[model samples]
Target: MDRYLNHHLKISGVSQQLFADAAVTAIQQGSGGLLRRANHLARGALIAAAHEKNQIVSAEHVRIASTELI
Candidate 1:
């Protein structure tokens, strides 16, 4: 969880709490919850892939994962 938070903060330049709160808002309203969950899962996969590749997580990776999931 810390890794995910740190990755998001570093890559997106947003605070962990702020990102999390926005995710919760998405869960409650926008995207009907499933998209929110899919996004979270995609983020996790991106982080894992970045870690494995020894690279900084990028928005491109997240975008591709989201597209593939959809």
Candidate 2:
């Protein structure tokens, strides 16, 4: 999960992990620990955070991520 997330994060122009611990937990639980879902959730959370002008991905961002996930 770390490797996959790192790759995606790099491609997304994120230099390092910015997900709050709770947000990480939320992404894991919310995605059922599935890599694909986790990836989508993480990406979506980044987008949500960006939309809100937040530098850190919070649990709220994770919720927004889930709602926006396809």
Best by TM-score: 2
Over the stretch 8-61, how does candidate 2's per-residue lDDT look in tens digits? 778879797888888888988899979889988988998999998989899899
Please tell me which predicted candidate would have the highest lDDT against the true structure: 2
Flag clash pairs in model 1: none
Per-residue alpha-carbon lDDT of model 1 for 31-52, expressed as tens digits? 3446455456546545655666
* Cα deviation of 61, candidate 1, in Å: 0.4
In model 2, where do residues sit more than 4 Å from their true spots? 1-13
The estimated TM-scores of all candidates read 0.33, 0.79
Please report how far candidate 2 places residue 64 from its true position, in Å. Answer: 0.7
- Quote the lDDT for 63 in model 2: 95
Residue 60 miss distance in model 1 (angstroms): 0.4
